[model samples]
Target: MSYRNTGTLFTVLVFLFATAGARAWAGSQSKLVAFTVDSVLAADTNKGIDVRIASMGARLRKVFSYTTYRLISRQRRRTQCGRMTGFDLPGGRILHVEPRTVVGDTIGMELVLFQGPRPVMTTELRLKRHAVLMIGGPHYEQGMLIIAITVDTPGSHDVLVHEPRIHQHQRLHAVSTPGQAP
Candidate 1:
């Protein structure tokens, strides 16, 4: 074959290889959108000591999708704790004085957050089997929690951790400090 013909063939091969590589990395964009609504809050409450409270409700839906490109064998895979927050409200707190209680194998996961007004928060945690999802409380202004999990399979897996129901309630009250009047 002529030099020009050889060069053309090489270019075509290179293009195909590059395109394949990109597609492999992205998995499937359409699939990803399927598993996108991981979690949602259907009920929330924000109440102060004044006996006044505001309430809200929310819904969490599946928000992500994945497909196996090569399966990577059927080996057991583990994932570290993964956590993401959708909101970080200031001056808000989580009202849970009781220590966390773990009942059974699948009955010990609780997360709650409260905001004053015009603000809300959401979080998402994607994990595999035998993994733990740790949820801390709102500390200072930007306190956060952690979620740890492990994947038991190597094939493509999708997880949707959603509440599908949340009600938010909050009360308005003036901050109490030294030299402050009610």
Candidate 2:
């Protein structure tokens, strides 16, 4: 074969391989699940307490197609115990969560708050399927810092969100903290 023809054939072969490899890599990626994180501020009062939800509404409306608010009703609080799942947060903070065990409608999980990379505070939480799990701070401004996590699993609408509760009946497994000793 001529040199010019040989070069053209080689280029086409390389392009075919590259397309096949790209498809394989895309197929291997794990499907991502959607979840919501809300930060709220609460203050203690003589009557009881005053609660204020942070402005996640505007942001949610922009990012998500469907948005709704659901109040957290039943929650089981716990101290530091069990395995941990590390979640990277803003301002160089990390949130570690460990789901221990579940009983009936309640699911137990441990949370370890970290600044930079060090563990600052550790606590346990028991949450339901559609409950908001609140984590407050030692103190931020006049009110306490509260981080509310709502697990919004996709239902009939699958185009916008992916369901996180695919295997609800599966046993809870411990996830190792990223960039830390196991």
Candidate 3:
């Protein structure tokens, strides 16, 4: 083949390879969404936000207008799309998350907060991979509860160390603080 023909073929092959790589990455995106649920108590206890959520303290303060924000409990889970997953919050409430679809890099899901037998708040959310969403306003012991839901990075099913699987019955340690014994 001539040099011009060879150059044309090379350019075509490079374009094909790049397109294939992009498609492969999109195909490999998992159907799973990892959720990190943090239940925080917000009141005038003067403790401020806990270390785990201190990075978002400014947002919490501006929204909730509370003096203290303490993490009461945290739970993690990996749920599939079209399936509903529940997390137990303080004051005997349940926050249900149902992941629906992943379009591009955004994960869409529905969330429902249930108090006892009644459903309180039901809404849908679209979040980018690795973003945190906070939902609050449930009365608890001394203060209200602010629940933070963090969506892990896409295709992170392999690196989940502390998540509860929705399908299997596996035994795992409950989430604990740094200095506390598990």
Candidate 4:
């Protein structure tokens, strides 16, 4: 082959190899995610917690007196691995969450709840896309406190709740999942 033709062939081979390497590297990188934090309260009732949450409508009414109890608050946050965010909730409670690891469609997170800088509760959660994690009361009267965390992803409907009444509450809603539309 002529020297010029040989050189052209070498250049084309190098370009193809470089492009393949770049695509491999890009495929290995973790995907970024965004999540939202919501805090809500309901009047403490004699009905079982399952019954109460099942009946909870799309719009929650403020039955408990905020003035008498702790203030209710909501905040939106966006974060990636190694980053942390905080949300303030009713009854002087603050929630701190950090994403520890993200693999494929699963996210590993650390969640901590604090009452005035004192850590009241801490837990780890692995959430899938479009999933929600709800944490309920530490109970005031018949009133219950709910803290919900949801990820922004399409068709990812997984709901996990960690609280004292979760088992009993799970039994009530057989047809609908916690995060799914009721």
Best by lDDT: 3
What order do candidates take by TM-score, descending?
Answer: 3, 4, 2, 1
Candidate 4, 60-131: lDDT as tens digits: 222222212222445667765666778877777888888776666778889999987899899988886545
Clashes of 3: 0
Per-prediction RMSD in angstroms? 18.6, 14.8, 13.2, 9.8
For model 3, how does the per-residue alpha-carbon lDDT over 1-182 read when each residue is reduced to its tens digit?
99999999999999999999988655544476778898988888788778877666765665556788888898998877777889998887888998887776677899999897699999998986645577766677887777878776446543423222234333356464221111
What is the lDDT for 53 in model 4?
Answer: 41
Q: Candidate 2 has what TM-score?
A: 0.37
lDDT of 3: 0.74
Off by over 4 Å in 1: 28-130, 137-182
What is the number of backbone collisions in each predicted candidate, taken in the order shown?
A: 36, 2, 0, 4
**Stronger candidate by TM-score (2 vs 4):** 4
Model 3, residue 16: C-alpha shift (Å): 20
Estimate the overall C-alpha local distance difference test score of candidate 4. 0.59
lDDT of 1 by residue, 1-182 (tens): 99999999999999999999888544432111111111111111222111110110121111111110111111122221122112232344321111122212121212334455432344433333333332223233222221112222223353433233334433256455212111
lDDT for predicted candidate 1 compared with the true structure: 0.27
- Candidate 2 lDDT tens digits, 81-128: 243445555445567666565443445666688887688988876766
lDDT of 4 at 47: 30
Clash pairs for candidate 2: 78-124, 85-97
Question: How do the candidates rank by lDDT, highest first?
Answer: 3, 4, 2, 1
Model 3 segments more than 4 A misplaced: 1-30, 156-182
Q: Give all TM-scores, in the order shown.
A: 0.28, 0.37, 0.65, 0.53
